[model samples]
Target: MVLSDLGRRINAAVSDLSRAPNLDEKAFDSMIKEICAALLSADVNVKLVGNLRKSIREQVKFKDLPPNTNNNTKRRLIQQAVFDHLTHLVDPHAEPYKPKKGKSNVIMFVGLQGAGKTTTCTKLARYYQTRGFKACLVCADTFRAGAYDQLKQNATKAKIPYYGSLTETDPAVVAAAGVARFRKEKFEIIIVDTSGRHQQEADLFAEMVQVQTAIKPDQTIMVLDGTIGQAVESQSTAFKQTADFGAIIITKTDGGAAGGGAISAVAATHTPIIFLGTGEHMMDLERFEPKAFISRLLGYGDMSGLIDHIQSITRDSAAMKETQKHLAEGIFTLRDMKEQITNIMKMGPLSKVAGMIPGLGGMMGGMSDADGTEKLKRMIYIYDSMTAKELESDGKILVEQPTRMTRIAHGSGTSVREVEELLTQHKVMAGIAKNMGQNKQNMQRAQKMMQGPNSKQQAAAMQKRLQSMGGAGRGMPGMGGDLSQMMQMMGQGGGGMPNMAQMQQMMSQMGGGGLGGLGNMFGGGGGGGRGRGR
Candidate 1:
């Protein structure tokens, strides 16, 4: 039921379109109404959505769509229109990290309290450190007693030099000193961590200007809580107007609402979201991609850093052994299935993962991505609800007995058909699990083929074929599951499939430990915490 809001909207739109006789002006109008209603209800920017609806209406009215366009074609057109509109709202890529014609590249962090600005500063330092930059930290947040100590601790752990003064006087002085020291140390990147403050505070805004003047940072990033919704627009606007914010990093996305509002807020501001803070862990940071982001919002998985996660977490021997077991015995139990799902969920979302595959996203384009994500969540929930007996039995009793199915549906607040669909999906996945060893081998073979003497010829042929086939006709088997696994691999390294399992375990523990307050903190209880800087 996590996707209840988006799901209901998609169903309504599909239903309305299904009833239409053809893709005409009248049908397009009705579709627009459904889309507008859905997007507005989901807290999308009202004016932006309205303008998008207007554009779609005019396009359908004036442009000559293919004759004999059916509901399916219209649905696809609507999707394209929405995608194009949303893409325009996202920030253009900023210049990569390169030293300006100066001593060192200085980056400043600013945001509201508890927005994770301090943590993000450290992460950025580490990110640059990994990229061979000699990064230094500047703790300008003298307001909080432990703020200096905490940042210094992280700096020590990262083996980076840091500068902070104990005085609670002007922050600009401390920042100036930090930059001077970093310059003396011959550091390549100097990151300053400022005290968190609301943009509405005139005093804080004034203090930010002094700090900006003192450090003359190459990039000033506004770090907002991803849980904050459409209000991000105001936050971005305030900071950009005050200090010329170069980018935005939305933190705490791993736990919260869909983070859709944050995405829209960034789009509205035309500021690129540079990074997403997925968890409290230092390594849980990632660069942003608009398409992958949209796909995740629509319930897809991302695979960009999946291979890296796998490399970090899983030993080759372990994967090879599991692969061998699956191929030789061809029996996949609930445990194996759970492992697979957990691994994929870590990469981010199911759809994102599939989209990473060269030819998969286009083929699965019209599939209700939001609905699919919800379905994946439901499947995970059902697994969570199951007793050990039920899981080991391969869901036999649940499938055979209607009474049990009804009980499960009631317990899960899902329809029996939904439960049935989960079972069917499980069966298909179980088969794929058994065949994965072979598929991975084949993929490796293909990779090797591309490196061989006929590489250019084969590449040319493949490109021509893909060009002729277009995006939709390509069939990418098991790509959906591949996507899910990839995300898991990214979150934690060594590919031991800990991403979803760990999250589920953490959730279960949190749920049981009477930390009910945490759920409310995520804005899922009463839904009152709907916007940022409120």
Candidate 2:
């Protein structure tokens, strides 16, 4: 079983238990049995699965519950226990080394051949480069033929600075020279890509030691193939003994059925996994967080990860800044909506973005990326069909004139209903923007605080406030309290804007309609209608 299949099976078991009329120990045990079976099929270690089953049973203790406890309460306890245990199964209670700005942080990569060390090195470099770090790559894999050429091509495509010696036969010599040169140039993040053999031979261990000695790296990361299954344990252990790597990065996570096993095996070794290579794309790497990973795995969505992606992608966009200014004033015009849509397009594939939304993921589970992207493009066409006056208005003028809607539909080559649906989506967001405008002063203050010197401290303080207000389980129903608290947090300058929890609540109100009539397109039993151009 793949990770997605495992997640769906486990989720179905939990959901079945939740819907059971008799919330007794029998049903609970059945759910546990199903979950364990699913995990085992996914290649998760038997001992780990057994421990998880035992832990869930101990935590829930269905028989020990109060006689007056309602089924709802009992269900929540069971679900929470499953979520916590699944999270614990992948968490290595250790923190990865964080690179400091303005300083050279040498990150060394080690793993067996074909584990994707070369590609991952460039990805890591680009990741930091996007985050305002002066990141560069050093290709020191002399054992592998064409390693320098491959690194050069990747680095050139990503536009990240790189240093590699095509003529150097000794990996250590190239690594030392690259690091020394980058340090002299004051590059903040220097990543050294080392050579790997097919097997953990003595020569490979000696080569790794020599490179480590040459670079004296700030952090050493082992790249593991997610398809290695239980073998990940022995492989990681051998590398750990030889290189003492500070962190791990698992590649091919999006492809293999043994991904779950690889994660569990690595966690058993007590070394933190920093990232997972989800795809071959340069932007496919995802930061590893146990809770967020498990949450997304179980189809619950990951708000924090979405926020990080948004921040990383839109950090320097002037258009985004302009939209933020407009949002501060409580104005969300069609142009602003268009800009938001464009940003979503830039974020990545629609399937991946949908998974970050609470209920949207499961709703669009069967829709392919091409279909979703086409749906979004049609909405953009509607915006493009509008006149300048129409785009600048709050979409009320278009509604006042039915002919304008028809004109937009004709011009955009879409149906009148899709045009209307687009307006509906805009209306929902416009209402949120108006509410935000009502609290403009608070939003301004929050923005300033976030951009100020003590921004990190202020952000942490606000996060604590959100958690206090039950932001942790915002995916659950009845989020009105959380929404109000989020607005209040904005008012007090505690947070910059409405968070994922707040956005989820708002999107739920539209029945998942925010993304260019996406709710209508997917929720109305079909893909609705395609434009003439499509």
Write model 2 residue lDDT over 140-202, tens digit each, in one string. 999888999999999999999999987879999999999999999999999999887644488
For each candidate in turn, the TM-score is 0.58, 0.86
Model 2 vs truth, CA RMSD: 5.6
Candidate 1, poorest ten consecutive residues by summed lDDT: 512-521
Q: Model 1 Cα displacement at 187 (Å)?
A: 3.5
RMSD for each of the candidates: 12.6, 5.6
Best by TM-score: 2
- Candidate 1 ranges with C-alpha deviation above 4 Å: 1-30, 70-72, 92-103, 130-133, 153-161, 258-264, 305-458, 461-534
Error of 1 at 464 (Å): 10
In model 2, the runs with Cα more than 4 Å from the true position are: 400-403, 440-507, 510-521, 525-530
lDDT of 2 at 52: 92
Which tens-of-lDDT digit does each residue in 1-534 have in candidate 1?
122355346446645665666656777677678767777665667777777777766655526766666666666666555545545545464543445433688999988888888888888887666566788899999776789989988888878788898875679999999898888878888999998887778988899899999988888888988666677678777787888787888888666354556656666556678778876666667767665454333333344544444333233336435744754555566655555555545545444344333223333444555644554565566566566777666667777777877766556655666666656555655554444543454444434545668855664455454435431132223222232232343342222212333333433333311111112111222112111221
